[model samples]
Target chain A: MEESKQEIRLPRLGEPAPDFEAPTTHGTIRLDDYKGSWLVLFSHPADFTPVCTTEFMAFAEIYEELQKRGVELLGISVDSITSHIAWVRNVEEKAGVKIPFPIIADLNKEVAGRFGMVHPGQSKTETVRCVFVIDPNQIVRAMIYYPLTTGRNMAEVLRLIDALQTIDQHGVATPANWKPGDMVIVPPPNTQEMAKERLKQRYECVDWYFCKKKL
Target chain B: MGCISPDGTPTESGKKMLLALQKGLRSPQDIAKETGLPLFRVRSGLRDIAVAGLAEQKDDSYELSPKGTELVASLL
Candidate 1:
């Protein structure tokens, strides 16, 4: 007798994001609605928690910067819509900063389960901090996971988005500590002749395999 | 390379340890227990924090240095 197996699909780099429609603070949002813009889909454990509160505030502060780069932010938690609304109101009133993004209320863990945010070893009922940087085409470009105790680096998140957009525009990779206006790595040459030619290229080359050029 | 190690960014465990340190969780064992991370990973994170000049060892416990405090403050 053959046993039936369930296929598990996790969103990965260079692959399409798992689409979903969910209720949010702003309204019910669908993944396809953000088709032409980059999306940062992030998950937190719960609202009203200290670490999660700080993260939400940080994300709110960077809302404009992300928008300027044509990127949108979507926050998700396994909390009800009522709780999300109240928390957003409380945060805005206390912090005096406007949260211009919609936060998804994944009360049933539907979105969380689909995104693999619920790590049993971490906490069965809470979602760990997970960030998925999806490109304009809905491809998962980069992913970062943080435990519940940690708050994410907003600067690093912005930098990653910039790097992803840069790579999309130019077929190149970023080097360590790469920021905007920094030298970017050139794609490695496939052929020996190309490698030899790469060394003679105008870009600064530490070696044939490692060449960097300014954007 | 950036000031952060292991790909110029703190690993997840390192981040967790740093947050715990910011909250006055000084002992590595305490951080491990609080953050639900393995003791070895917590120790590794503490070492990374020290190397980054974010924390200082005092006897068997650790505390955030001035620079580390400043860094955490800037995050908020």
Candidate 2:
């Protein structure tokens, strides 16, 4: 039955995100340092690559806005800091967006392997584009894996972060194709009486079982 | 100092240890436990024992050589 649905091989989700302590141009950073804050742990292909350059620029432009929402970004690639520095410099000069986040020097690929980013069948020397959004409590809220050729949607990433946070904080869920400012799913009624009462109320909600409330 | 060069060296204990690790052992503590050596020494040995396609670290542990485990056995 499960196979009938697409055979999805996903990374470890709903658990503690993998911890990494690696040297960067900004010196060492332990994954635990971002424990109390939301984290966007992302992986990229080889350095100085064109597609990855655009993704980096997009993330950099929105880095501050993400932080305003109490989130941090950490980038990883299987390249040395020398390569990473050169790539960032090129992106900054050509793309005109300076990266504010630190890029991990995963030359040994320890952290990449831990996160299962190294999809050898796709590309042996490169990592498939992967992003993990982890909440403050160390649980993975969402994950996205992209093909090497197709660039990721940066705005969608921000929207997902917003959606997840909203549902979590409001004790609700989002409807299909949910976006910011859209109505959210109301919590299922606990008792039959409450269910009947919920149906009678007009809350922009469609039905008692599946109800929605404006963000 | 008894040291193995990062890039080049014919064969050292560290290299041998990496071979031993690739053959079967996973954790440095497990390798140390099997080798009857100090845990710290095992970690120090691995820092310089960078053999391509030899070993991979996983889940806060290490993985053995994916293939050619039999060829590695001749050394032990």
Candidate 3:
């Protein structure tokens, strides 16, 4: 069993996300059901905890924003469905914020194991904080992991989604710390002839290989 | 499916959405605004409502079918 656990494959970026069907606070949901939209599949350490509660509230705050961007949020942890329901209700009552998204009650840890959320060194029985940004095509676009002590930055999450969608829609890469409406990095030229033309074009080019453009 | 029971009864949010439709809200956005449910939930609920034959869509708007009208009448 230990050997098999060691061999558990962590999902990689640009690969199909491992499929899952799990019961949630809302109902049973399948990964395939979210194929036509972007999904932010995230796992927290445990429910009713301080950091996770704040995080849930933060997520609720951005739920509509994510919806506007055609993204869905699904949270998970190695907690029972009843526990999830109680905790979400508690959060709603105390924080006066509604959790609009579904949260997977991964009591069996099957989904956690598939996503590599269970880090033995972090907590053998609980999942670590992990985030997987999957595109509309169901491909894993990005992955982020946070240690148990630190809470995640929700703004960065929105920014990355913006970056991914911008990249897809405009066919350009975002520069470091890119945000919406910011200048985008153009694909660099490979051939010398193309390189010469790149500088002559209507872009902000430091050189033939480095160019940025406003979209 | 999220807001519908296996036997096709509308759950809380589903009932709210159907109620919004009974109030003559047609678009998902309008239903969401009227019911205060998340727009995503409203949209997903619309799909399930149509699947259950309770609502029908025309263009971007939705209204109750005869079955839906009867159900809402009973829900009251």
Candidate 4:
């Protein structure tokens, strides 16, 4: 008998995001279409569930703010386009929050399979909450996952974007709980010569290996 | 069909998308509908044209930039 199992390919940071063409609430979309913008490709278990609903509202609330930061949001689930549309309309009618982003309706699970959104250990039928932060060049910058029972925190998502953009803009790493205006961690020197010279610079330093600087 | 080349030249579909925008089509869906192109093609074309400095994004819509308008006029 032939083997029945297939290996799941999860996305990794610094790798190109898996390209996909799928039907969305806005219309048919492809990963290539977002070539010039940062994308937050997030997946929910379903459309009408309580936790997903709340997450949708929160995503809606940050839609404009994300746009201002040159980020676009694309949601996904295994639900049909009909279900996605109806749920969006319902959210607008009852929750009064307009979902401004496009949502991919992965009825065939093609996208979920590519991104490994469905964890068989958790549930076979539904996808877990997953987020892939893709940069403008279509590289997967970060990935976050949550169980079915939990909703995502929008602030953390925003902060992650800020951190990545800051790293790209200023060539520095962000510390834990790092927000904008906080001192950024400088890269440690590889050479002893540079290490000695690094201490002479006007940056906050605990040691040669650890230094923080203001951009 | 592909929309734009890596060097920023507009392919056939990209040109059609730009013409659609010149005819007052703004959103990607609208451009796709008007040009009879796939939504993905329209969107990818829009991004490519924007990168080539031929288009500008305004909120949820896109429009031909001054450079884009000049290019279209020269093509005509």
In order, candidate lDDTs are 0.82, 0.73, 0.88, 0.87
What tens-digit string does per-residue lDDT give for candidate 3 at A62-98?
8888989989999999999889989989988888988
Best by lDDT: 3
Q: Residues B30-58, candidate 3, lDDT per residue (tens digit)? A: 99789987565677678778888999998
Task: Give the poorly placed runs of model 3, Cα more than 4 Å off.
Answer: A1-5, B1-9, B16-73
- TM-scores for every candidate against the unseen true structure: 0.71, 0.68, 0.80, 0.77
Q: Can you tell me which runs of candidate 1 are displaced by over 4 Å?
A: A1-9, B1-76
Consecutive 10-residue window with the lowest summed lDDT within model 3 chain B: B36-45
lDDT at B9, model 3: 88
RMSD of 3: 4.4
Model 2 per-residue lDDT tens digits across residues A19-71: 67776644355676566678898999888888998899899988978977878
Give candidate 4 misplaced runs (Cα > 4 Å).
Answer: A1-6, B1-76
TM-score of 4: 0.77
Give the per-residue lDDT of model 1 (tens digit) for A1-215: 99654333467788888888787765456776677678999999999998999999999889889978988899999999889888988888998867767788998888887788888768878889999998878888899999988999999999999998898899999999999999999999999999999988999999999999998
Give the alpha carbon lDDT tens digit for every residue of B1-76 in model 2: 1124435441455445656576454766677667654343455444434243345666646655553244355546
lDDT of 4 by residue, A30-127 (tens): 89888878999999999889999999999999988887888989999999988999999999999898998888999888999999999977777788
Q: Which ten residues in a row have the lowest lDDT in candidate 2 chain A?
A: A1-10
What is the full ranking by DockQ, best candidate first?
3, 4, 2, 1
Q: Is candidate 2 or candidate 3 better by lDDT?
A: 3
